[model samples]
Target: MALDALGSPAAARDGMLDVTRDGRPSARIHVTSRGGEGRALVLVHGAGVDGSFFGGLASAFAGRRVVTYDRRGCGVSSDALDGDWSLDAQAADLAAIIRKAGAPADVVAHSLGSLVAMRALELAPGLMRRLVLIEPPLFVGLDPADPVFQNLVRAGQALAKGHTSTLFMLALERENMGDAIRPFTQDELAFRERDVQTHADHEAGWMLAYKPDLARIRAQGVPVLLCMSERSASTYHARNQDFLARGMGADLMRLPGGHNAPRDYPDEVATRLSTWL
Candidate 1:
């Protein structure tokens, strides 16, 4: 786990891993390895979207082996659609990938992916060196009957029902994104459209609860940095941030964009995370 400062960009190595779960071919994860090995940095994406959205951000960490891969049943990964799709399952998948990348790897995850990353931490605490979580809605300190939770359910349903625009709006509102979304770029709209088919797999994660023992994480000396922004001022976000900062001794980083900061402001997030790393 000898980590060096971020260096120049290296050529990417792309491959697909035949990763297994329950002694079966559960996933064929499409992995992209950017830069060369110094410290392995694994980027875990949230629901509905794939690893492709992380291209811009991964490039910033040039030689530090920025690894981005689609989770099971999302993007090009195999659809183990029958089994449990909860955070626990996702954590197992993450553990396999982290083991592939080598131990004590640095992980940077966003949204739902952050939840999976933390679950993996619980499952294999020694597998990770540190974590950079971007607006992970852990739903720990928040009420079950809260409006944000309701909106998230709605967003998931909207995504399942092919209501793409409605899903987008609900996602923004859930993250407390302001009045902007007027004209989505071609790339922006296209990404959502492409993810529509994969929404069913992600929607299941919404039902899962995240109740990590913060003291244990802190005791392990595994540093966790929770990154959010002014725009991501939802109650869910605030509660989790409070829990992590107060309970886990985790660091809080307020970035410039919303919960989707990793995709929206990859360069800025990368710059901040690189310096922090």
Candidate 2:
């Protein structure tokens, strides 16, 4: 497999697949695959970004097939939102991708993507063999009065009050990711900017209201690894990861860098993933 100048898988290996829900054509997901042998390792991205968000990290899984796809309404995937932004629908999309990649694949999901992956595992047990959840914003587990939670609510409210999605997304990245976004290239930043509306309009509220089915996930008996960035360990994201690690009986990994560690410090994240998986 070839890598681009940025160390991401080149566009020559890109593919497209249609995701169906209830036997109806739902989304046209853009997928990128590379590497060979071993079980497929699927990369699921979070909000405000697309599958390319994992470009830096996906190429590091030596000998294992790595797959990454743009979620509906984000990246090069279907732009039609309709009712597809719901958590169930997003999970269904993930399930379809896992099935296409061959069942029993391992998954590495970041932020909101982690929630979708967990829900997918619950909805269709045994589709994924191992799970790595990276700093998922499981807000339900956090204190309602916490400053971060309160600020998130305010951000949403501001969006409802007529803030531009781009501005909202910029604020969000600054707040949650801080200087982590600085290491990303200009093209990467533009890619995320384009999908701000999809997140600000359709996904943010749903993410805030989502309640993880921890019992079902725990019952699945799938081995899970919870990853938290060193910088984020002092924020609400770390709290959420800590809560999930305990609830799901998952092994905790402390990686270098901030929330966007996979992008800023891909080799380090990949090294840990290789060891964990």
* Top of the candidates by lDDT: 2
The residue-by-residue lDDT of candidate 2 on 224-267, one tens digit each, is: 99998888855667767767877888998988888888877888
Q: What clash pairs does model 1 have?
A: none
Off by over 4 Å in 2: 1-12, 81-83, 159-190
Give me candidate 1's TM-score against the actual structure. 0.80
Give the worst 10-residue stretch by lDDT in candidate 1: 1-10
Q: Per-residue lDDT for 230-258 in model 1, tens only?
A: 67665478756786687778888888766
lDDT for model 1, please: 0.71
Task: Kindly give the number of clashing pairs for every candidate.
Answer: 0, 0
The number of residue pairs in model 1 that clash at the backbone is 0
Superposing every Cα of model 1 onto the true structure, what RMSD results? 5.1
Best TM-score among the predictions, by candidate number: 2
